[model samples]
Target chain A: MTIWQRLRHTLRHGPAPLPAAAPSAETAAALAARLDAAAQRRLGRSLAIRHVGAGGCDGCELELRALNGIVYDLERFGLRFVTSPRHADILLATGPLTRTMAEALARTHAAMGEPKWVVAVGDCAIDGGVFKGSYACLGGITTLPVDLVIRGCPPTPWQVLEGLRALIEANATPAR
Target chain B: MSAAAAIIRAGAASGQRPWPRHALSRERWQAMAAALDAADAPSLQGVWAEAERVHALFLDAGSPLAASVEVDGGSYPALSPHCPAASWFERMIHDLFGHTAEGGRDARGWLDHGAWATAAPLGPRQAALPPRVGAPEPPEFLPVEGEDLNQIGLGPVAGAIAEPAHLRLTAQGETLVRLEVRLGYAHKGTLGLMRGTPPRAAARFAARLSGSATVAHGLAYAHAVEAALGVAPPPRAVALRAVMAELERIRAHLDAAAAILAEAGAAFLETRFGWHREAMHEAAGRAFGHRLMMDAVAPGGLATDLAADGAAAIRAALAALAAELPDLVRRLDRSASLGAGIGRIAPDLALRFGASGPVGRASRRASGHGGDARLVPGYPPYPVLGLDVPTRAEGDVAARLRVRLDELPESARLLRALLEALPDGTIATALPAASGEGLGVAESSRGTVWHWVRIEGGLVAAAFARDPDWLHWPLLEAAMRNGMLADLPLCAASFGLTSSGVDL
Candidate 1:
């Protein structure tokens, strides 16, 4: 159909229906409860994340970007990506920690405020994944004190969310 | 014929496919560098180096040819003085291979930022040293001389969920005078890792070269491997490959549109575009096993055939997108903020960099100089099924977006056609243990992705995968000149260059 017809059809029909809720919604209630308890306890119901890429292929970043889409709606959980490490409550690090980016990643982690968590995302961030044993890489994010690890060549957005939920649940103090 | 192609044709052919690779003497290689000074010179596509030789790929007219010169006494004649596009590649070649470009314009290090344990890690074994100690030294940026100009350093780690790269912007007030991009922060030693491994084992590295262009990279690497072994994949595999490529292009364009809209502060529009992108990803996941389809296009053929109901899932997703795309595009065209002619790239600039894909099409739209690998190098299915190459004469951010918008429907159409005529046959063919050099080219979302591979006894002896971003990154720096600093992100999103793609 011509663009005009498509526009007219849209005007008459309002708009196409939004796709059904993603498969991740099946575990939404459990994840929301866990996120709520942890966020309320330590983060004032909000978590600011700073992403540090340390030389792995950008596959992890792609999945991370998906979290902000309408379906994932990451901010609705009070989780947001921030620009500066100083403003971040958690450092979401990816890549195999290549030597070139090692110092920068270290500085970024050092710059973050206390009570911050380092959540290593992707197998490369855990132990270099496919890039293991390369001369230029340091294997993984060994310089930082990692609090949680999300495993996958690149974990799906759902898996990342589950990993973050677990991070909060493990650290947040129980209500008296 | 272009001087470079003439020289390439005269040399001994080395059995590369789609295009030929020729071994040239030192004198002839120097002559090719001199020939680039002519007004009608072929564009320099890429420059890479191995332990004993350095190679240069060039585009003459619409076809590609490569020439390699043996590195005697550890140096080769520099092409950067004549062709500015070769400057970065020359620097990278020196850094990685430790081969000097004698009389080269820029002698500074490209990828080595002092954090590495050794110098010239990919160079000869004797030259490799033990790991260095302490913090890495800062990279030096070119000096900008002018009155009342201050410099601002942006990254190495900047923006939200973006790969790391340092940007040094020298500005007078709000207008950027010079924007220098310092990359290599995302370098993962991909080439070094690929060496000594079988093509099948090393295909994963190519697929991951750029996450957004995984299918394109994978397809190109698979083609290179197939060419080297003199094996042809089943017809069904070839058609399926095209299907995945078009899907990836459609999804990536949607993501680029969303980013541009988001930068323009069109929240509702941005979300709508993101919604479409999410649907595409879902469709890909349902069709293939992976959301990104990483490692799906393996050497020989495919890792697996399409899942049951894959075609139905893909058709549903396309129908949904088709219903919404026109209205969304109309809304975008009507938005004054998005339509403003910001980030204009001249056609000459695009041609000089050998830009391809949407960015090249948008810039060279009026000139009709843009060439898609699918059409030029002539791949199967694409040549028969045909493609509608979209273009926009404006060469600005809006023009780029319009080109992308125009491409979405065409891709949807192509996908539908491909799915309808889905070939029925064995999905894969066994590859034989053989050795040769081959070049594989694929038109990716960002631009053309070229993978050059040399196999020896069924193992990858040397490999270089050049993403179109190597050219587009330089174009981004050029386009940002004299523009408002605030528009940098918007302009970059429109170009859609990836840092990790070239950081390898």
Candidate 2:
């Protein structure tokens, strides 16, 4: 596929969808275009991020690692996964937020500085997809007003890209 | 004693205690923990107190005949039990729930340093408070102080591809005397998240707590549910679960081996081992759902059967990994830095703690469920295939790595055998008509991973899963003593600690 075609394709479908999966190809394409835009905008800026989960299958977290893999290279975008809340800008939360992790999540979220966007990735984060309102987890974006939601148990790398794509776009144009 | 006999005997040793290791519900576990307060044995992981019941696991390692005990610490400050291994877990429990052990050693808290003001909790029920403005400042952790030695602080902010741990090293110049640790910077509060999810779906949550050892955690979680519900998995499923476990074991050990090689500074040899592990993971991704093999097992059986071609692919992958291990071993042997400073660390302390996995095996404690016990239920097939294996006596970093490297081929051999004898039967059993509680133990790549489950009206009431990281973290702190600051990451990564897995 040509680069333009690839970008268009990503903007629509997100990433390569699985056999009979629910997400649309165009959505994947759009998500991809967005992810690209997010990274492109932050070419030289240093960003610190922390991943939090209400509760999840953990597939979402693993996919986040791909951001560091040879292909995506989150570091190239100057994105760093920091251990201390002292050095984080964006708090990336996944999972459904089990009762066990509720305090930890709140504790972590509270520790971050202002200008922080809480990105709730995956279906679990969007609305407790697989683990819907289980006693352990309430639901993401609902429990804590989520800034952005990427829908998928584990959103695809490009959707993660696109969601991130949407992230920077939102940052560029503040909500009315 | 045989593993089962040993278990029964171990249970008998603590017969005098009021909690007696067999409580099933959150209330019972909490009551048992409260009862054991003065009886010795105290430290908790994941304090979950809800209408369902309250549950947490207390670790007591001072007496090995009764190595560690899991208790339910409920209302009323319970009596305390603190072995060095329980250090990380206790801090975590205090951070989550208001629960506190009355007089445990090292009562200095972990996560709940008044960092967050919203009731400092893990909850399904809350006051529905609006998002408060004016952020609360995180409390500074109490730094260790002493005149006898200088304190060294290691990473809360560390290098990428590394987990965060703060090690306070006390030493006189270079010769180390003591190492105190401030853990839980990576606390995710996962256990608190499991409150209402059905036992089946919650099993997936456990599997991902750590990136590696996915199979063991899944199996343990599933087994806990199965036990609590009085369910038994299909025989074929049991065999399959065991197969996946050994597959995970082989891969985890391979990863550790590669790290050891890298730590020993043998880039040439390390790269080869690293590639071998990568190749193994690729095969796993093909055979299992994901490379880390997350959520592949459930209470009834496996999430899905490994397809015929997938098994064939895995068998081939195992063969490939086994083929390269011998050469990898020879290269690792040539690495001049194998035992960087083995002299200073106390080999005796690691043994005394009842350390499990390669760490224990290296220290002269006969371990490795497959090689040492002969009763590692799932090895007739898959990575451990028909084989003659052996353990070593060095009990140091090098020895542990060697055990893992040696175990890799054996796991491959077992995987090959499993493929050769693939059975035709249901992959999962019907859920049993069980209620109350039951426990399950699976020897993970690290060591024995335990899961305690509580069920009521066919719903999960409470479940506590413990990883060997809880048992080994303090020992790692102990090992850091006498070793220079440079060896911190190398020593830690060599052990391949799993923070989240141990946290809950």
Candidate 3:
């Protein structure tokens, strides 16, 4: 297909109007400040991330992996994914929340330490993309509080990197 | 031609205290228990609960054939033998339906820990309760430990990635001693999702269970429904299914090749492989309507048939891939670092686990189950065309890569063959509703994926989809021994085991 055709396809199937794209919560300057501070004290902001499967085709996982690859390189910013909920600084949930996994999600979120962030990545993670409730879905990460939502059936690697960058940026910002 | 006869002979050779195939229900179940008691079958392959009964398939150590036994749900809660693999499925049956395998030990549940109001899933003729939130108390994860073994835990989260599973790897200074895997972080009750979703809709759900094996799941689900209804898919549909399977195979192999490069630290090679995989996915999306082929196949036929333009595009993409893969593999073979980075394990491990797909093939096991034999009902036109079976002897991770490398070209060749002769006929029209229990199996890229479905008067009674992961996960544990800790990721990538596929 030609480039124009590809663009048209995206226009036709792309996610619902971005809902104002959730205005950036923090500026680059603030993000830089926190990074420098973390570096100075030798105590970088520790992020214990939780991966939630709301309802998705795992393409989100692949793109998310791409962001962590050598190309996008997420570790450089000192953010890391964690196993235990008690240790989490962010719950990086995916998929559209299903009825069965709902309790696990709620408990996992409640288990996280203070100053938590929930970022829903992917169209399904945001609003149950391809699997919009035939029988199993309860809907997106909104089943719980979501600090950020990235849209796309499975967002691109760049978008994944951007969303994480926003989370760190937002964390450093003073609540308005 | 006689799957039943082949199974009986293979069973006796495997030393299963054999029961004649025509034995009645009680007679067969009792005989199977006796065989297991006699240590004739070393492993219980799997079990499925349909209607009010549960059937168990068993195989003796190194046996080529398998035997099955069916017992009353009430009787089962007490009579089944203590086979490890059978344990999970039994517990699953109990959790969903309320039936127990008699004398089944541990009694610990799989995932349904009294979370739902419904009775055990298979015990009830129809579903009773609404979806529930939590299993009673989460089962205590069996902590893995030994003298002075440093434990490094990975996942549930490692970054922004969405794959969910908490892996506890116990090792002594990077040499892994034990791997206790905790799966189901993403288990959304997909099997449960299939309970009544018309097979057409259910196939879509199955397709999404694992992104990589979408086509496999789609075909397997379709096949189960087809068999349940006893309707053979059309000739064109069969031809198309083969083409799609081959396409899925080559695409996955390309991804595996790229992953091998990534593990070997060959940056350029890795990128080349990644691009190829993307190109394949794109081509697939254009041809089959879903990049992953989700919802393509339906009961007795196809939901969507291949269009001429789509077929032409797929052929073109395949031609390009076929041309490029040779040079790419040649580079990998010549790279000393990559060759050294391949798995260093023994073939014995792969054998012990009965690993399937490229892993089994690399360990020198037959990779392809003769397709023509599986087309028993002649639904797909597979009997008309043959498939290439890839094999290797090293059984190491590198051997797995080599198997994939060889298979990649073969898949492309298959694509060309299928496309050149793409049949012109109805994909499928319809079939009568299933009147009894039936079994359906598809040769997925990984290996044979089976779906056992029971239809009672036209509605789905139960659907049990089991992928090759049953054999794959165990082999992964076997492969990890004696490798350096960093190499663990490389090892896993080489195998690319899917937890979602396994958990279901």
Candidate 4:
């Protein structure tokens, strides 16, 4: 096909439909409600997440990446990943805290501004999961004050969204 | 004699299956190590240690061979001096097993950054040293001497939503003079964790060793266990395993292509690839019940059978991908920015590093040493149903992208063929409670994944899973030499090396 024809085809077809297994509208609505309520109180309708991979496998990191893709569209829900911890309001950490990374994780949490929240993603981050007794790891993100924990070998993208919603709701004041 | 034949003939035959493994005396092992510098030396695949011996895996003229040397007085002759690829593994062995590589190059510790409570946690000196009391000292990097070169350290955590690894780059203006990757931040003592556990239990760790290559690693681990027990998974299970592997390769290649496009500032192409990747993952979830297919392949057979509608879901996803792939490829070809000479890997360097999978295929192209594990050390179902391995000569970002693009359809075709000929039988076969040593190799999206397992009485005695990143990371370091700092992301994305896989 010619370039013009291809462009026309793309424009007419639009993007492919999302998969059938994408989270339901009600799930999205519940998350939006929590985000809205949190914004009214203090969050301003956005949560900037700074992800730190402690000592776990890359499973959680993969799921977290999925959240930013078109399917999950995490940014649409006012959540986005940032490079620097100082710019973040929520520190999203994964893995069992390896000894080499324990200090770094602690420092990253400290760099965040006050009223910050820590959400540990994955079973390893919850309590070291499969790596619990390994000598090289501290077995979870316990050195910092953790406000939320999402558990799975590596939690799915939807589970991570729910955890974020729960974090906002728990800290969010009741709608006045 | 060939290095492999020499090593095998010199030592007493060990029980390792599907590949010959022999236990050699220190002298013979040193002789073999010395021979590694020869022009026709076998390629070093991996190196790891047990309490009593240090083992090395080699790929000799498309055949897998293993050799071990008993550690006398907790020290053995090092292979790094003869084989540059063995350097990292040698250092890692020293750190984890407390076995010194006598006269080894770069004696610095690897994977242990003074963070562990004890030195050589897996070694004989596990409790000999006093616990570390203070904050660990900063890691040492090779000093760069140049008037204008300034060093910049990036990540144990970096800009991307990826694994943690520290990259130290010495640069003159925007051009890198040297790039040194200091990893181990993601080390969870995976090998130590697998010790003494049943193969079924330890398979979980293998599956998680690199989440992106879950099926490949899991399949390799299963293959190793099956080999050790002399059990073969049912034909249907074998075909399904191959099916899952192809699905994984397609998804990974799409993700990789998307990452490269995103780094190159081609947002439209990037989004399209991302859409396809997510669609693939969703199909996997629908078919196998997990987006990543984690823990799906177990030691004996599979954890569960494919869903009833699994074939339909997979076919639909592949059809959509196939429909859009041509336009995507055409657009990618027209984008001059991506095709520019950036992050190019030389063919000689690729061969020396034993680069495998798409990375190797891109560099080596049609020439020999396109180290696809499935082809080399041939595996089931894949061999029975013929396959085509893609090749590209450029070895740049564009070449890697082209290789991946070619692979997507190849994988899709293989998936369709496997589905059509999907055999009907039990999905699992029980492994006997037996003892033996086995090595398993699988071609992951990144490259060849090697898992070495020794099962003692149905329990894992000692194990090591070597991800291809272990070899490819050094290639990335070499590729980035003298390249612009801004091109680092594109180079990294093109290589698609995972830190956790190597860090473990």
Candidate 2 residues A30-145, lDDT tens each?
44465455453332245677866444544565567555443455554456677777677777877655444556667767887765657788776777664554433455546565
- Consecutive 10-residue window with the lowest summed lDDT within model 3 chain A: A15-24
C-alpha DockQ for predicted model 1 = 0.55
Per-candidate TM-score against the hidden true structure: 0.94, 0.70, 0.75, 0.94
lDDT of each: 0.85, 0.57, 0.62, 0.86
lDDT of 2 at B338: 80
Error of 2 at A118 (Å): 9.9
Give one digit per residue, the lDDT tens place, for model 4 in B1-504.
576458656788888987878888888898888888776688888999999889998888888878999899989999888888988998899889889999888788779999998888888778777888988778989977869889999988887587889999999999998999988998899999899998998998999899999999999999998988898999889999998999999999999998889888998888878888988988999999998999999987899789999999999999988888898888887875684688899888788788898889999735455768887788998777888888888889888888899988889999999999889989989888889988998999999999999999988999999999999999999999999999999889999888888878
- Give the CA lDDT, 0 to 100, for residue A127 in model 1: 93
Q: In model 4 chain B, where is the ten-residue run with the lowest total lDDT? A: B1-10
- Please give, for residues B117-236, the per-residue lDDT of candidate 2 as tens digits: 443356333344243356444534446455666766654434443444456666777756667666554445556556555777677667766656778878877866775665667767
Please compute DockQ, using alpha carbons, for every candidate against the native two-chain complex.
0.55, 0.08, 0.17, 0.60
Which has the greatest TM-score? 4
- Return the DockQ of model 3: 0.17
**Candidate 3 lDDT, A1-176, residue by residue in tens:** 33355358769987211222332555445544554554422223445566665435566665565454444455666666665778767788787665456776788788887756678887777777655653445667766766567786566655666667665654555433
Ranking by TM-score: 4, 1, 3, 2
RMSD after CA superposition, every candidate = 3.6, 9.0, 8.3, 3.0
- Arrange candidates by lDDT, descending: 4, 1, 3, 2
How far out, in Å, is residue B232 in model 2? 2.1
Kindly report the fnat of each predicted structure, to 2 decimals: 0.78, 0.03, 0.22, 0.73
lDDT of 3 by residue, B178-285 (tens): 776655555556666666646665676667767777777778777767655656788888878877887887877877677767767888677656766766766777
Q: Evaluated on chain B only, what are the TM-scores of all the candidate structures, in order?
A: 0.97, 0.79, 0.83, 0.98
